[model samples]
Target: MPAICKLARQRLHWLGLSVCLLTLAPEAAHSQDMREVRRTVRYLTSRHLHGRGYTHHGDQRAAAFLARQFKSLGLVPFKSAAAYTQPFPLTVNTFPGRLAVTVDGHKLQPGQDFILAPESAGGRFTASVVYFDSLALGQEGARQQFLAQPLQAVALVLTQPDYQRIQAQPLLAQKLGEARALVILVPGKLTASLAPRQVAQPKLLVAAPAWPHAARQITLVLDACLQENYRTQNVLGYIPGTARLDSLLVVTAHYDHLGELGRHHFFPGANDNASGTSMLLQLARHLSQPSHRLRYTVVFIGFSGEEAGLLGSRYFTAHPLFPLDKVRFLLNLDLVGTGDTGATVVNGTLHPKEYQLLQQLNTGPASVGPLSARGRAANSDHFPFSEAGVPAFFLYTRGGIAAYHDVDDRAETLPLTRYNELFQLLSQFLTHLAH
Candidate 1:
């Protein structure tokens, strides 16, 4: 009887050990699985992708690659979608002719020394560089001061906070009448980064240069010409659900970047968006099985023309292949590769419950750390969905790499240390949300 009791106790001990090991196994394996996340980031952000813009066929190649990945993962095509590709239209403006700027007899090359506004009317004149301190609309005194000047030569107006608002009211331009030319200098405060060419407004007019100017002698050279037709596209794929076919949880990432401008220049956009696109592919693969019993369908979208005023997303919302009203939530991944410090959850303040749930899930064995929250901002692809009243959130790593919108934002420079934790947290969050 004593021997039998001892044997039973040993069996119980062994059972307890097995359970403990099984519980720890997932975490151990997950830590190692993070290497795959790093690998994905590396591949997507490789130079072979070439900034993923339309002009270089980089965007199309990226779309095809993503589609292949989705197919491999066994994600079924959404209804009426042939092979998981959703085509959209876009009009991109590019510089086709020689764009030059000569200030005080100093010649400047396009993009390096100066960028021609796509809408500027091409002409030439010799005008003094007039400086407008602040062009606020309601400031009647400043408006009068600007209009009263002998607007002959190039008006080199410095940009101010109220410039956009005042410019939105076209009467301000009418009041100033015509000058030799207009040279708007983006203020030192606002000129810290390169503004994306495709997204800027059509404030300037495009024309060939025959040197048309109201004033004479001042060679106000409007050396910019527009290539009216440029192409870009948005990539789409989907994984069908079992029980809830009506509702969808959309995952999106923009795969476009600022293309080359001059020698030794290209915005690689590794952390800016390639990181996010790779995450979308990973999620599609992770949730591919039909037996997973998803409560909502999953859609993966790789948007182009995101650098151009959310153009891809806007087009999708306008001409949706799937019903927009059926979309329950959107998770837009932007920069999730390098969050060693933490990550920011935009729209968290708008959806506190979901944010808190994510926070809680992130506090476990795969802790990523120091998560921050921000109010809803129309800064990324999630903006369109939120505007359409669909619940959405944009996730991005908070720190580590600050080389955004520059050539320095390369894949090899990315710090993907916390990507595994982020992936686990997102996977858990999706699982919980689906339930």
Candidate 2:
């Protein structure tokens, strides 16, 4: 099957969570600089960055990298805007030091036999094991009873099906966390994530086959901490418009991704927002040119803590450098690595004028492939601005690879399919904005 067709089918199957691992056809290439996009993705996904998560100050490294990119591109901070970065603080749970788990005499491996819970409170817990059967979990009355009861002993173990059911209700953690420890039997693989909040009890996962059926107890040691005021920043740069000084256009992409799973494993996030950030940098490079400059000032932002929440953009819109009313329009990009089928626009219906303009430019023989419109969503950095009454749209490329929030979303595997075309389409639309 053709690569585009396969990606489209897979994308339809995955419902907006996918990536592009196929090769970019040379004949499809355009003048837009994909070399820089490739280079940026490669460096960001490199091991030293540790998936750009909070685990190792990789997020700070990512912020610094964006600042450097902005400085290199000759874009300057708007008058009221602070230097380059607007730093903020957050509290999060992290497992950077020691992580270990064992049931009886058998050792459990991270992301293999067992995994530590992201929200797990850091501690060492050992006690006699208690089991919760699938029948108990499947029964509504028993499940409610389990949630209400005070768990005693070292750890509580559950079958794979029970574990999945429990995971569906995040608030269930409050109950589970009251236990000394919680254990789940995973069937095959485990992909860990950064937990937004904390649970009082430590949690461990065990592989189904490695589960100690006869074991009386379990032991888990995790050097995790709920670090408060963890500092991070957003990187911003702008090109003063040649025409209207008061009016402006803002373009943005979140640069944060799921950080280190442990010491050895990290999610690369090549297609998540790194691909979108690469697009932002390329736009900065292009729009900075005097010949390509716009009628309204163009602000480019590389947002942080987007994976944690829309923290950076929310901060900026709340404490905007310039007046919020001055922003003529905002376009936020999340995943732009592949456009095998086309691109989808969030807020297309809410902001019909801009959406119509986009449709106009996205057609013709040299079109930017198919364009799909979606209703309002708080799905990306655009939401905060939209809620603040600023017209904003988040655009993400559709169809490609299926890797997301995992180690598989690598730079080498991304195709950059239809990237040049989308770049052209956006530039054309920007040129006609408010004209």
Candidate 3:
């Protein structure tokens, strides 16, 4: 019995060695491509790509580059019979030109001093300002007074508490949607998001009062475009399996982010998604190699319109090119630039066995720290797959610079703390999962 056990251990070790041998070139080539990752991130986040948004052909440029990479890696078409990219249409409100904001006759900075709301309807506005305590938004009398005056330009000076109160007032939202050129004075840095839908008015979020609230008028010299059916694409390619070719393992990452703030400053989404997309490409290159082919088919996807919502992933699931039931598992990667404290897995709790298996496989590779399991979040491209009942996990690195959806998330700053270890862990996990 002792001899048999030793023999078993010997065989398992040899098997592992064989697998590593087959994967050596692909794995090392991928690790060497961290330089490539940096290059790709820089290109995607560069000024010319315009933050990879729907405007200025930035998103399309990124799609073209990724498609070229896919072709170069010899990744075959999957789900699509015609091409590597799956085209889709979506509408987004974009501030493409003349984004100027003036308060009380003083022209303030565009990105530094204020942000135009995503739902804003574009056009120039010159109106006498009516200052209201954001606190008043909690009171019906105060809200009604502002809402009742249709032609009046309103400004709400918000403290954190005031902002909270205003959020509770549903009627205020209804009124604001109908109001034109509303000014909101917010404390701290200006953040932006893609509008879920367009509205009849534009809201300007300005930095809170600098020297008491004496501004009596507001002016916006803006040129915002509401792009309807803006054509964008999701890039996809696959490597067939030697055995279970029909069964699939999907790897995905969203390549979209908040594009440019006018023509001057682009939001470089390096950590937001460029990191993840670069990793996806690395994985693609590794799997595309014939020597490293798996027993189950693997698909690589670079999703667009993720910032607008999980539109691409949702569309893919709704109209999948392959059978959803044939899917063995789906792994969604995002914000993978840092892993000082290891990584977090969304939906890890929901699928304990697979999660446990991953952790088990992660035991030897101490470089990535430890894996953290988290509750499901709809904040990424994985949400749509989770909704469709496809077994999925969204993985993201947890530590390092806290650059999220902002301009600071540049390619030059990413440390890639444990990217190699993360890659190794996934490689091991997928091997075990496929087995």
TM-score of 2: 0.82
Could you give me the TM-score of model 1 versus the true structure?
0.69
Q: How well is each residue in 73-185 modelled by candidate 2, as lDDT tens digits?
A: 67897565456888888666776667767777677666556666678776776777877755554678776777766685657877667767767767564566667877777
* Alpha carbon lDDT at 33, candidate 2: 50
lDDT of 1 by residue, 257-312 (tens): 65543223345777888889878866775676444447778888888778767888
How well is each residue in 56-147 modelled by candidate 3, as lDDT tens digits? 88898788777777776778986463579888888888877777777777888766677777877676867776555553465667766767
Candidate 2 Cα misplacement greater than 4 A, ranges = 1-32, 79-82, 102-116, 125-129, 137-151, 159-175, 185-193, 204-219, 364-366
TM-score of each: 0.69, 0.82, 0.86
Clashes of 2: 3
* C-alpha lDDT score of every prediction, in listed order: 0.64, 0.76, 0.77
Q: Give Cα distance to truth, residue 117, candidate 1, Å.
A: 4.8
Which pairs of residues collide in model 3?
none
Which segments of candidate 1 are over 4 A away from where they belong?
Answer: 1-50, 96-231, 260-264, 289-296
Worst window of 10 by summed lDDT in candidate 2: 15-24
**Model 2 Cα displacement at 273 (Å)?**
1.3
Name the 10 consecutive residues with the lowest summed lDDT in model 3.
11-20
Instruction: Please give the RMSD to the true structure for each candidate, in Å.
Output: 13.6, 8.9, 10.6
